[model samples]
Target chain A: MIKLQNIEKVYRTDTIETLALNGINLHVAKGEFLSIMGPSGCGKSTLLNIMGLLDEPSKGELHIDGHTVTRLSDKELAGFRNKRLGFIFQSYHLINDLNVLDNVELPLLYRKVNAKERRRLAAAALEKVGLSNRLQHFPSQLSGGQKQRVAIARAIVGEPEIILADEPTGNLDSAMGNEVMDILIQLNQHDKTTIVMVTHDEQMARKTHRLVRLFDGSQVQ
Target chain B: MLKNYFKIAIAVLKRRKFFTFISLFGISFTLATLLVLTAFLDRIVNHEYPDAKRKQSLYISGIEERGERARSNSGLSISYIKRYVLPMKLPGAIAFSSRSNGTNTYFHGKKIGIDYKFVNSVFWDILEFDFLEGKPFTVQQEKNLEKVAVISQDLRDNYFGKDVPAVGQYLEANNEKYRVTGVVRNVPASTYMLSSDMYIPYTLTKDDMNTPSYFGEYAAILLAKKTSDIPAIKKEYEDIVRRVPHTQKRFLKTTSLADSYLDAYIRGGSQESKQKVWVYTALGIFISLIVFLPIVNLVNINVTRIMERSSEIGVRKAFGATRKALVYQFIVENIILTLIGGLVGLVLAQLVMIILNNADLIKNLHLSLNFTVLFIGLLTCLVFGFLSGVYPAWRMSRFPIVKALKA
Candidate 1:
């Protein structure tokens, strides 16, 4: 669950000022699957980033799982993120140096899980995503869909309450995009995992339980 | 946790082999220079005054006033010794002096040039020379002496056959025959005062002492009963010299033997001569600084490399890695790199020392590992590693997850 009230994010250069998010108020309940749709410069990703605790709000009240995180220190925020939230990026951002198994095990490593348990949990996550056979394959060797699957497995390996998928299908072909979307949908349905996906595709947005559209810097129902 | 850091460091180095090689080579070259300089300095400092007992011996010389000018002489006039030194009730007061020169001649049919010093009977008591054959001459033999000599092994081998008895055999010196009484080993090349091929009693040739060339003032070496009483004894000797009625007006003052030796060598030359030691010291320090500069530059490069890993740092931070952990990781990485370079540098230095020693570029040149050098090298590596890593680690850890991720 996440909440944002009157959130404002501004970017300033030496000669100009830009409003990334303005007076935005939104909420997502537990186990809810929400898709945020917006044009290129409409602050959709900015809003998602703020909700994921990755960015600070110029003026806002933010609550995640009943704790107000707007005033938390950087160290505290990082700890909160590591324990409660997971991230799946459009680029799949898996460290190329590591294999699929190690990439998936990275989140648990930060959690200080013993190596044996980390390996077991990472293998199980890979198995759930139908990537058990590709555990040793590096991201460079994997197809786009397989990389995305690996990213999803990494996200779920920590057993976090909320998963933030930023343009999850942006880099994949349509068929691979469908497969990634299906995996996300299955996670939301079977495991009751809450997922907030940001995408520009109308058809993709239509598949989620609810959609929040953004124009300029404001959110709309 | 440390294992993980090492693994990550290895991975980084393996991935960027060229960068690693360049950095390592730069560091290793600098370290090698440092090692060489350190070893050389150690040799210079430790090689001086090999005989600890010699420090207890005082070298007494004379300063003569010829009209308006005062000349300090390292050689002792035998008259001064008989008049002042022998009459003193100072126990352990033994004095010896020598005249040294090189001569070439046939030794057992082989042509050779050997250095020779003609000294007195008291020379054996003052200088601790180890004899390989026969015994040192007695004071009675020197007082009631005839033609007698002591030869070094180098001269014995050259003049007589290797197994031939050199003692009691007559050797030609300045066309005059002198019987050999003793044979001693060759002196080490590193010594300032050299051991000689032939030592003849000063009494046997007392007539030669009357000539300024033969006496030239012999080096009057004095061994005190208690070395700690040297200052007092030197003061007494100076007082006796000042009282010796001189026709020159400048000969009115007293001077210690230490001051006399210093006045002879150190003061007689240009001021630059005194500064020569400081020049060597400065050169040593300058070379060390030259080596230090490249290492500092490499440290800066290491800092920049660490900065480039900000994204990885941010991800690690987001994974719950503390600022301390990040610092530790970077410092450990630097230490590992430097230690590798240090080992390579040590090996390189040893190789260089071996080559130089074999070539005889420097006398007795050898690489030695001592506590001071070892401590300095280790401390230098640790301090540099920490200093180089701190700023980069701080900058990396300060990265905002949102900004870094977006970048």
Candidate 2:
């Protein structure tokens, strides 16, 4: 579960100020598959980033999985993120130098997991994403759809409580996009995993359990 | 985790071949130069043969006479050593030697230049030399002004055939023939005072050595019975010097200094404690610059190189890597890089040493990577790795995740 009360984010420069998020209040229950829709510059990714604890909100309170994450120190926040949440980026931000298995093993590394166990779990997660055959393939060697699938396996490798996906299918064709959406649905329905996705695709939003729209840094629906 | 870091580091290096080559070249060249320098300095300051008891010996290298119109600073005369230094109650041996003179000798129609020194028989008792044949001339031989000499291995090889026996053979120099009594190991040229090609008794020289004058081309070596007694010997020498009795009327007062070979090389005029401070400080600064300049350049290069990995850092941080972890990973990567460079440098330094020793750049100087030099080279590599790696690692670790991701 997640909760937010009057979260605000501001970007500042010497001569200009921009409000990225303004008094945003939103929440999602356990096991919910939620999609956020917004136009360009509407703070959808900013909100997802705040929720993932990748960025701090300027002024507000945020509670994730019954913990007040806004007050955690940087080190504590890193630990929290490693143990509780995972992220999938639009660009499939897998380290190009690491093979698919090693990329999936990244989050588990911070947990001090033994290398053997990490490899086993990483392989299993890759299998779940239908990428067992690509374990040794590098990110550069993978196709776009395969790369996105590898990113999904990496995101779920740690078995995090929440998954934040920022435009996971933004760069894929319709068939690949639907395949990714189908995997997310299976994870939500079968594994009871909670996911928050940010997208501009109405069709993708229609597949989710709930939709929230953002306009000019505010939650509009 | 470290394995992963190594994997990425190797991948990145292989991906950026030009940068890796440039970095490796700089590190290897700097380290090789440093290793060569270390070998040369080690030979000069801690050489064996002739000065093996260097720690337990002191040298009265020069005497200073101050007159109203004229001042002179020169080596001690033989008579001055007899009256002022030999009577010292300190438990030690006193030996004096004339400055080496260069002479040309002919053998088989080829000209060979030899440096010769006139030393007292006690010189053998004061310093240790590795003799390959025969023995040092006795005190009686020296007192009798016998025409005998000890020759270096190199000189023997040059004067006689390489495989020929040199002992009991006559070596002619300056039109004077002396039977070689001993063939000792060659002394490195850096040990200038004891590096002569041949040593002969001072009594055999034509010039009067026992002049009452305070200056001559002669220096004395005082070897303490124990290393700890060196201070006592120095104090006794100072007491005798204060009572020097104004030998020359025009040069009314005389002053002199006896010091360790290192101190003698650094501070020549007087043995003041203040001068010792200046000597060590200057040496410290010189060494620091030699070490620090290369590190600064490496740090500059590393900063730019690490910046290119900002996105990788961002991904790690986002996944769960603490700043400490990232910094540690980067430093390890750097250490690995420099250690490879260090191996290359070690080989390069050995090659350079072989070329230098064979070329006869400075006669009799053999630069080899002894244990001490090798240990120092390793330490320099580690220091270079840590110092150059730290700042760039810290800077990269501090990059905000959002900014690094954008980069």
Candidate 3:
């Protein structure tokens, strides 16, 4: 479970102070799949980043699994994020230099897991994502859909408490998008994995356990 | 984990050939030059063959004459060595030698330049010289001012042919004919002190301690019976100097062996006789210059590399890699880079030394890769790598994962 209270995110420059998020209070229960839908520049990605601990809200109380995470040091936050959170970017964000197996093993590597075991878990995760045959293929060699599949495998390999995906299927074709959506649904249904995804598709939003819409950095409904 | 990072580092370097080339250029060029200079310095400060007893030997290269506002200095004379130096009972062997002279001889219708050194028989006892044919001129030969001379293998080969015996033959030099008494191995030009092509007795050069002012063209090398005997020798020499009624009352006299090379090269007031901070400062700045240029260039290269790899760093951080991990990865990559460069630099340094020896840039100067030089070279590369990598690594590691990933 994750909680955010009176969250405020402000972007500051030499002569500008822009409000990216304001007075946003939300909570997602354990094993719940949630979708955040909004137009472009509606702070959807910013909110997701804040929740993922990749960026800190200017002012807020953040609690993950009943533990305060906002006050944690950078080092502590990294450990916490590694153990509790996974992120899937619209770009798939795979390290292009590494092969699919290596990209999938990234999360487990930070945990100091043994190489042999990491390889096993990564292979298994890739198998679940239907990418078992593309183990040695680099990201450059993969199709858009296959790259997304590899990203999903990387996300679930660590078995984190929460998955934060920003536009997980934004760059894929309709059929590939649906396939990815189906995989997310299967994870939510069979694995009972909580996923907080930000998307613009109403059909995708309807498939989640709950949906929240944001406009101008505030949750309207 | 480290192995993985190393693999990635090597791969990444291989991926971007231009960046790798730029980094290697700076690292190798910098280390090569520094190692060459270091090797030369080592040769000068630490003797290997002839002057093996450099630590136990004291040299009187020159003397200073001072009187209130008037002062003058010159190389030692026979009078000074006999009255003030050879009389010392503590010396294992006291030898006097002339400063190397240049002369011309005809070998097979070609004019050959030869460096000539005039010395007493005791010179043979002080420094170790390998003899190939016959033996050194004896004290009796020196006393008799014998025309017999010692010639190097190079000179023997040029004049009498390599197969013929040089010891029994006569060679004409400086319009004087002398029978060869000994043939020695051709010494490298780097060995500056005893690197002459020909050797003759100082008595043959018309030398007696008849000079009155205690100054002439000679250097005395005093080998101590025991290292502890040096203090007494120095004290006794200074006492003899004090007692000498100056040929010129206005000329105050002082003489001591310059302790270090800096002292020998830099001649001045009493300050020159002791170690100065600027000497170390100059040395430090010289060494830093050799190392800093490459490191500075490397820092810029590393900065560019960090920028290019920022996304990869973010992905790693997002996956739970700590700032420490990111920093360590970059540093290791740099270390690997520099070590490769270090090996190349080492090879380059050997090549430079070979050229220097072949070119005869310094007389009898033969340099090889010793353990000390290799250690210094490797350390330079490592430190250069670490220094250049840490800053860029730290800067990139501080990037917010979200911002970096988006970039």
DockQ of each: 0.38, 0.73, 0.78
lDDT of 2 by residue, B1-407 (tens): 88998998899788889888887887888888889998998988887667778899888887887789867777877788777878878847888888889999999997899999999999998888889998999999999988999999889889897957899999999899999999998887777777799999988988765787877777888888999999988888888888887766787667777798887756554534467689889878877887788788889989998999888888788888888888899888888888988999999999999999999898889899999999998888888888899999999988888788778
Estimate the TM-score for candidate 2.
Answer: 0.95
lDDT tens readout by residue for model 1, A1-221:
89999999999899998999999999999999999998999999889888888778998899998999999876687778878888888888787767788878877876778988999999999999999999988889999999999999988998888999999999999999999999999999999999999998888999999999999999877
- Regions more than 4 Å wrong, model 3: B66-71, B207-209, B231-255, B258-271, B274-281
Models sorted by TM-score, best on top: 2, 3, 1
Error of 3 at A125 (Å): 1.0
Reference-based lDDT, each prediction: 0.73, 0.88, 0.84
Comparing 2 and 3 on DockQ, the stronger one: 3
- Chain B alone, TM-score, model 3: 0.90
lDDT of 2 by residue, A1-221 (tens): 99999999999999999999999999999999999999999999889989988888999999998899999887998898888888888888889889999999999999979999999999999999999999899999988999999989888999988899999999999999999989888888888889999998999999999999999999999
lDDT by residue for model 3 over A27-66, one digit each (tens)? Answer: 9999999999999998999999999999999998999999
Report the CA-based lDDT of candidate 2 relative to the real structure: 0.88
lDDT tens per residue, model 3, B1-407: 87678778888888899999989988888889999989987776675566677777766677777778877777778877777777777778888777778989897798888888888899888878889999999999889878989998888877887658888788989889899989987766655456688989888785566777667777777788878877777676667766766667787655455333334433322223443556667889998888887788899989998898878988899889999989998999999999999998999999999998898777667787898889989888889889999999999999988879978
| Winner by lDDT | 2
Docking class of 3: medium
The CAPRI quality class of candidate 2 comes to medium
